[model samples]
Target: MKTVVITGGAGFLGSHLCDLFIKKGHRVICLDNFLTGKKSNVAALERDRHFVLVEQDVSRPFRVAGSVHLILHFASPASPVDYYRYPLETMRVGSMGTHHALELARAKKAVFLMASTSEIYGDPLVHPQTEEYWGNVNPIGPRSVYDETKRFSEALTMAYRRAYLLDTKIVRIFNTYGPRMRIDDGRAIPNFIAQALKNKPLTIYGNGMQTRSFCYVSDLVEGIYRLSRSRYHDPVNLGNPREMTLKELIVFIRTMTNSKSKIVYKPLPKDDPKQRQPDISRARVLLKWQPRVAVEEGLPTTIAWFRDRI
Candidate 1:
């Protein structure tokens, strides 16, 4: 069986990755600092012989047993409220944390898959951002700390691949939602859902005209697993092609929960994308991956999950 190490293995995406690796008959070493990770996410895996959790900060160098077959780096504050509130910590983890993961990958001679975000697209001018787009980003803006750090993380990975001949891959993830999402966050899906469930006014920023593509977490994880097993070394976009506006999304959530909440408008946050979607042609062509779960199918499950929690 292959041995795999996943950073941030207790967070929403990381916890899911740990489960996937362990289920596929791989020894999973989950490294997380619990900065934003929840213990409940990994509680189910504690009984599994193949699953091990280690609370380690990736800012420092650490060692793991056995030769790791793959390293999934998903350790960073992903939400806007997170990055904005803890900008330095976010930057450190993205920069220093990624450096440590790359070192671990090199030590184990493993394939390292860096979880880059579509945030690198930064208010994308392109309709559906492809892997080739350079992106229109503000270097000194509020989102720059996160955006530039990811850009650096990608650059560092590419350099390591070229210089050290290490096997590395990158997936620029777009909007993903499902169980275990942070209810306090400002992501439209969770934000709207949480507000609606609590019988609070649903807040819409900037006329709610901004659009985003939503990918179910299951589909995203499937794509990540496929990319990790493949030989492609460059970045690939993994996201749902289905797009919708904020207003339409709020209405959908209101209908989904059968809540009596009215829509309230607020000024758009700085650096909010006008339009964002992924061009997954590369993922489709290379990894043979396309999102299977529709937003309709994914949303109900999420709504139920949140309903149970709050």
Candidate 2:
């Protein structure tokens, strides 16, 4: 079995990956500083023989003993709330953290995978953003901390691949949601679900016309796994192509939750993308992957998790 190391392994997506790899009989070392990641997320695997949880910040230089066949760099404050609250930390992880991860991969001659985001496309000028379209990002904006850092991470990964010939891959993740999502993470799915469950008004920012494509966590994870095994080194977009406006999502959640939550309006956040969608033609052709879980099917599962937690 291969030995895999996942940075940020105690976080939402990272914890799930740890479970997946361990289930497949691979030894997994999960590294996290817990700035945003919760120990409870990986609590179930504490006794597993193949799982090793390491509390270390990737931004700082760290080393591992023995052979490491794979390294997945997922260390970063992913949510808007988290990054906005810790902008400098976000920048450091995206840069120094990524650097350390790359060095580890190079040393072990392992496959390096970076978990990038669709935010790199930043208020995209192109509709249904494809992997080829360069993004339109405002460097001085509030959201740049997350967006630009991801962009830099991708660039740095590519540079390592070219200079050191280190096997590297980057997957640009779109809006993804599922169980273990913190209620106050400040993403749309959890925010709407929490507000609706609490019988509070669902807040819609800026007329709620801004569009986003949501991919269930399982679907996204499958796609990332496929990309990791494939030879294609260029960035791949992994997300459901179904697009919807914020207003529509709120209505759907209210109806699904059977709540009396009224809609409220707020000024839109600066640099928030007006339209967000992924053109996953490449993923479909290359990875032989497409999102199987529709929002209708996925919502209930997510709601049940939140219901139990809340």
Candidate 3:
């Protein structure tokens, strides 16, 4: 079995990757500092003999005991609230933490997969963002900490592939929601769900006309797994192509929860993309993958999980 090291393995997406790898009969070494990740996310795996949890700040250099077959660098604060709260830390993880992960991959001769986000296509001038899009990010804007760092990480990953001949893969993830997402994730799905469950006002920014494409977490991880095993060295967009507006999302959640929550309007955050969607044509051709779960099929399960937690 391959020994896979996952940085930020206790966070929302990372924890799910941990579960996927272990289920596929691989040894998993999970490293996290619990800054934005919670230990409870992976608590269920603590007793497994093949699962190893290491409390580590990956922005600092670290070493693993054995040979690693793959390293997935997913150690960064993803949400606006978390990044705005810890901007410098977010930058460090994207830069220094990514450097350390790449160094470890070089040492072990392991395939490296960098988890990137669609935010790289900030305020995207392109309607359905493709990997070819250079993006329209405001470098000095409030969201630069997350966007630019990810852009830097992508550049660094490509550099390693060119210079060191490292087998590196990058996946540009779009909006994903599922179980284990923090209720206060500061993203649209969880925020609306949490508010609906509590009978609170569902807040919508920017007249709720801006659009986003949501991919269920299970479908996203499956595509990621496929990419990890493939020979593709460039960034592949992994998200559902189905697009919806924020107002529609709010109404759906409210109806699903059978809540009396009213809609509240708020000013859109600066530099927030007016439209967000991915052109997954590359993923379809290269990975033979496309998202299977629809919002209609996935949201109920997510809402049910939140109901139990609340």
Q: Which pairs of residues collide in candidate 3?
A: none
Per-residue lDDT of model 1, residues 1-310, tens digit only: 9988999999999999998888888999999998877889999999999999999999778888778889999999889988898899889999999999999999889999999999998988887898899999999999998999999999999999999999999999999999998888668899999999988999999998889999999999989999999999999999999999999999999999999999999898888889998999999999889999998899999999999989
Question: Which residues of candidate 2, in runs, are more than 4 Å off?
Answer: none
Measured by lDDT, the strongest candidate is 3
lDDT of 2 by residue, 1-310 (tens): 9999999999999998988888888999999999999999999999998899999999999999999999999989999999999999999999999999999999999999999999999989999899999899999799999999899999999999999999999999999999998999999999999999999999998999899999999998889888889999999999989999999999999999999999999999898889999999999999999999999999999999999988
**Alpha-carbon runs more than 4 Å astray in model 1:** none
> Can you write out model 3's per-residue Cα lDDT over 170-209, one digit (the tens) per residue?
9999999999999997989999999999999999988999
Each candidate structure's TM-score, on Cα atoms with residue i matched to residue i, is 0.99, 0.99, 0.99
Q: Number of clashes in model 3? A: 0
Model 1: lDDT to the true structure: 0.92
Candidates in order have lDDT scores of 0.92, 0.94, 0.95
lDDT ranking from best candidate downward = 3, 2, 1
Question: Backbone collision count in every prediction?
Answer: 0, 0, 0
